[model samples]
Target: MALVVKYIVDGYHDLMDNKSDPRVNDWFLMSSPFYTLGICLGYVYIVKVLGPKFMESRKPFELKTLLIFYNLFQVIFSSWLFYESCVAGWLTHYSYRCQPVDYSRTPLAMRMVRGCWWYYISKFTEFLDTFFFVLRKKYDHVSTLHVIHHGVMPMSVWFGVKFTPGGHSTFFGFLNTFVHIIMYSYYLLAALGPRYQRYLWWKKYLTAIQMVQFILVMVHAFQLLFIDCNYPKAFVWWIGMHAVMFYFLFSNFYKETYNRNQARKEAKAAAAKAAALNGKPQNGVHQNGVEKNGSQKIGICFTSQTALYEHSSNTNGVKSVTNGYTSEETKTLRNRAFVPNGN
Candidate 1:
């Protein structure tokens, strides 16, 4: 096992240390696979195992202020990263395609390199997301998808910075930072309190935003394969495939959550309509198999049959069904019930 570990570490060092742009070597954790692997494994063990276990005997921490500040910090951090990405890529030096890593000491290229490192480091900061969940005892929030997304990012992006930083591929980080700005803004608002709940109705749209981001990333990455860009085709393929995978995962989650919710709503509506037609109010099903007026029910009237009927008021002011059918309004009743009510 020690020999195997030694070989793997040596290989990682050789690939990262020798081949990586020298400009990025001084950047923190830029060429250190050991640090990246250690941080990720430590994050997993803490959040998934140790944190939960420790919290089992303790009360969940109400870190409301801490969370609010943390979210605010992320918003600021993401905004800075996004600005840097724009300035380095779009605003100045980028051609949008085949933009190879500028290993020279030019200001714009170095700025982009720094931006790439920042973006890579940002992935490590995201570990706090799971930590926050563990501290709050919101273990449900720490899902498999969430863990994988956070845990894999640092290691995956480390390569991007180490090898192909400040290239056409940098768009991934740029777009991601833009998305994070919005996402962290949402988190910030949500952390505020109940007062912001109304504005948070757009929470459902966040998933849509993520799907759009994934689509955009996939398109951008896939475009490289068709064009004759100098950018590494293998990296492009990897990014494109990664984006596609996330797109499908997020799509399934969206459908399972929102689509099922919608289906449930439709089913409830159908059930309510059936109940109303059968003279069974949804609020409460009477033991006597009769619909009583003044009982609040959802959307429609409850009637036993489509034929002639009468509703009479008892002394208690509750409307009860009677056998006698009133001659008046009979045609109107038939039109409302047996006939189609569509306009």
Candidate 2:
């Protein structure tokens, strides 16, 4: 752990000293292997081939404990990012962009470098987000949106560090970290259970906030694109994909989860009302029997033939209508005619 920390510290120092990036040298290190292993593990877990019984044992999700730790981690992580963005923004505004970048230049600037690395690390930490879902057996929540969001973020951030490392990305790093501060904080509380369930008013709005983040990211990235700056276009491509995918998936989710759902409910209600007025079963409904054991109701129950005749000239008669069997067939089938008890 000490050696690893020293290596990270050295990586930053090398970047500051204008030496070659240590990441290139460390590509085959033990930590690199672990990262690959973690990604493989994530793939297996997401695919549900990792074993269910093990995951099930972790269910009945203890929200309180989960959120407590989750928020605690958020506080520290977001705080650092908030500070990093502020410091980077400060230096870039003043004189850091065009200078040779001396080590003694600015206290805040060094902090920003550290923050850049911190932001890179935070992306991988977010893998825990999916781990929690898997453990909770909320596999349905793991959609294309979730997997793509989780997988690509860390990689993009790492590319951020390897390429541009600072500038407008700080704004994004800052805003996203800020959002995460609120988001993970909410998740933490939500995990605490029903006591906090009533407090989850902004659940839908979280996606809106994410969309806002992408807009902000697009705006900031275009800043470097317009002016002379060091941020990578490759990283921009990655970020662009993230934004586009988020928009598509989230919009679809909103449409399906809310709009289309309400439309379906309304259509069903209208059909039911029409059926009631016609004195017949609805298009897919039946009044005679309820759905039982996943089976649709037949609604073919027979009543006493004479009692049910629309205008009974003779109670003993049988007549089949265009829509259905006659009252007498119903009575005969039900054995509801002839016997005193049946009648």
Candidate 3:
């Protein structure tokens, strides 16, 4: 046990002393990995455990105003990061194919180092994405993928800032920052209220954009394998593998969320059409074999399978359903059921 402990300590010292970027060695949360790790672990504990327990007895907080500002702030912050990344390397001098880290004290190199450090800090700020969900008691939105993605980012970026602050690998951060600008803009609009929901139809495309980003990162990182580059191979594998992992994860989410929703819509349409052809009511047979009347029960049986429908009667003696929900409540329920939980 003592030997193992000593070996681990020695390795830690070696990496910190000899392998890390000297320019960023004294920065906040950069001197050691434990600081970042502790914050991430605390985030997991709160979101998965303490946070839920705390909200169990309380009514969910309606942070409408707060959310608007938070999302707007994120949009602005992300835009700045993307611009800095571009000016530091991607736009000015960094080669897309095989750019290596500039460890010198030159102005451009220092600017990249500063950009990488701010990017690391930005990951911690994103913990609020999950925190807001927990506070609002949107537990279903806090999925395993969401938690893992948020929990791992800071620690992953810490290494980037610690070792290779700039280079081909920073391309991932560059792309990611750009994606956030779009993503947070969506969230900001959503927080404004139901009136803005009509403008938010392209939510599914956000996931597609994220998936594309991972693919781009993978291509940029893996190309180094075929060509000779001065960059470290370890970082190449690390960044490339992370991109591959996240790409598949986002792909699965897209299929489950959007594709499944589309399939349900098609099935519902076919069922409605078949019922219309047979001149029978659209509702399914009751337990005692009675036919349901009116659109009140229409789509109830089909949409109930997905638990996405709500039935309500209007003052007029007529009944109607719209897009798997009542016409009166579609706006509210759509946002609740369909909005991506910052994944």
Candidate 3 Cα RMSD (Å):
12.3
lDDT by residue for model 3 (252-295), tens? 99999999999999999998888777766556554323344543
Local accuracy by lDDT, each model: 0.78, 0.61, 0.86
What TM-score would each prediction reach against the true structure? 0.78, 0.63, 0.82
* Candidate with better lDDT, 1 vs 2: 1
Q: Mind giving the per-residue lDDT tens digits that candidate 2 earns over 153-259?
A: 66656555554455545556777888888888787777777878889987877877877887766665544445565445555566656666666777777777778
* Model 1 lDDT, full chain set: 0.78
Please identify model 1 stretches exceeding 4 Å from their true place.
1-13, 281-343
Q: Which candidate is the best by TM-score?
A: 3
Residue 238 CA error for candidate 1 (Å)?
2.5
Q: Candidate 1's residue-wise lDDT over 1-343, tens digit each?
A: 9999999989877887787788878778865777998998888899889999999989999899998999999999999999999887776768765677677888888888888888888998899989989999999888777887888888888878888887877888888998899999999999999999888888778888989989988888888778897778878987887788888878887888799999999999998888777866575654333334454321222355533322332223222346322223323332112221222
Model 3: pairs clashing at backbone N, Cα or C within 3 Å: none
Give the C-alpha lDDT of model 3. 0.86
Candidate 1: RMSD over Cα atoms? 8.7
RMSD of each: 8.7, 9.4, 12.3
Measured with C-alpha atoms, the lDDT of residue 319 in candidate 2 is: 57
